[model samples]
Target chain A: MAEHDSGGWTLERTIPSETAIGSELVSGLLAAMQEYAWPAAELFHVQLAYEEAIVNAIRHGNEFAADKTVQVRLSCTADEVRIEIADMGPGFDPDSLPDPRAEDRLEVPGGRGVMLIHELMSEVTYHPPGNRVTMIKRRPPSP
Target chain B: MAGFERLVVVDKEDISVVRFVDRKIIDASEIEQLGAELLSLVDIQQRKRLLLNFEGVEFLSSAALNKLITLHTRVKRAGGTVRICNLHPQIREVFAITRLDRMFEIASSESAGLAMF
Candidate 1:
């Protein structure tokens, strides 16, 4: 974890494939966002997207394997927040995911996490092998 | 009525008006428990109509949305229905982004949600 003179903070951690641990990390990020006075609605968006990404890493990427772990790095500045998450499991092709919004798929319960992450974040990119994902959310314009 | 740790359920006529006890429905275990409790409304208690009130809920994840979808599916299969109301603006935007706003009936007030049934 590192903090810079630019008033930005960065943190990197490798956590066990446990949702509780991920939640703790997220709580810390939320506190940092609050200290920076991130807008309330944007805070909700960050929380939702961050939670979804971490859960995907643990549940789908690692399959909750006891031997596997998830890597998370978060950086925040006055202008934007960036998050990257990677897992120890085999990667998947994001292109292969179905459109959750299809009329026929509306009733389906799963598969919305990836979509939500894409929509909520300002920008999203998936790395090679597909196990690593990076997301960015720019601060909304001041009212 | 059976007890629920995650929800507060009150029967209004034939509809079960349900409100969540947690402000943020993000925890994995808690989400699983919430799913089970909701399913019980149809499976065990035989509730035919449900109105989920999200008055104070400020945050929820895709996992929580999955539970609601599951409950909706079960209710439909049991010849019942589920309606949700009072979602915070951000939470409501989540539904819109996922297009779940098209999948579930959403109302601005409890009375409107109850009226949908």
Candidate 2:
């Protein structure tokens, strides 16, 4: 509930894992991030990546558990912005994910979310036990 | 973000181009909004072509890709065509993975997109 900012670094909210809360978290993060002057394209990328991660936590991690919660922590500095999305779901093997681009499996209906996340973020890592996703994006150097 | 700005251009020849003008299509909200806006481009009584310009879009989500398919189906059902152009390398990889590059007419540039009609 307490938000803090220092030297262009700020920490936002911790939200629940219900779909109803997803939009609010996204909007709040976007609003806070806008102050850091992220370019519109990168802003959108962050928004999308965050949404996908939270949705996965809500739908897959919590398995729609009404009592479950997902924590979203955002911090931004002059050089980079970092987001940590943690869920209580049973963690799965990230390596087990099939290649979404496999030539023979082109018609598959799912499995692209993580791929998109990897493409957008400067760094991505998964924490076991709680199934936390950490993503970082660096700001473009000033001209 | 530098070279292009978000530009939705509708030509009199019945083509609508929604240019991303930046690095990616990130969320379902923007994708839905784009679909809605594309629909509004035509009068209900007429059919129109659609071209999603990804010149600046470096990344794309599966949700956005699904929305594109939905848009294509809707426009096709209405007797129009849907084309895609200027896919960034990463985005092109996505389309290839989903095999959507085969589903849609993809061109290298705006002119190529126009020529598809």
Q: For model 2, state the Cα shift of residue B104 in Å.
A: 3.1
**Clashes per candidate (backbone, < 3 Å):** 0, 1
Please give the TM-score that candidate 2 achieves against the real structure. 0.65
Chain A TM-score for each candidate, in the given order?
A: 0.94, 0.87
Q: Point to the candidate with the largest lDDT.
A: 1
lDDT of 2 by residue, A1-143 (tens): 43645765555566676655764566655665677667766776677677678877877898878788888787776568788988888876677889766756444546777877777788999887648999998876666
Q: CA shift at B53, candidate 1, in angstroms? A: 0.4
- Give the C-alpha interface root-mean-square deviation per candidate: 0.8, 4.5
Off by over 4 Å in 2: A2-4, B1-61, B67-82, B85-103, B107-114
Give the docking tier of candidate 1.
high
lDDT of 1 by residue, B8-106 (tens): 999998999999999989889999999999999899999989999999998999889989999989998998888999999999999998889987899
DockQ for all candidate structures vs. native: 0.88, 0.18
- For every model shown, what is its TM-score relative to the native structure? 0.96, 0.65
lDDT for each residue of candidate 1 in A1-143, tens digit (9 for 90 to 100): 65554668788899999998997787667777887889988888888889999999999999999999999999888789899999987888888999989999988889998999989999999998999999999998887
Contacts from the true interface found in each model, as a fraction, amount to 0.90, 0.18
The complex in candidate 2 yields a DockQ of 0.18
lDDT of 2 by residue, B1-117 (tens): 112234456563666666764465554456666556555544352546878777766665676676666666667777787888888765676576466887788999989998998
TM-score of chain B of each: 0.97, 0.80
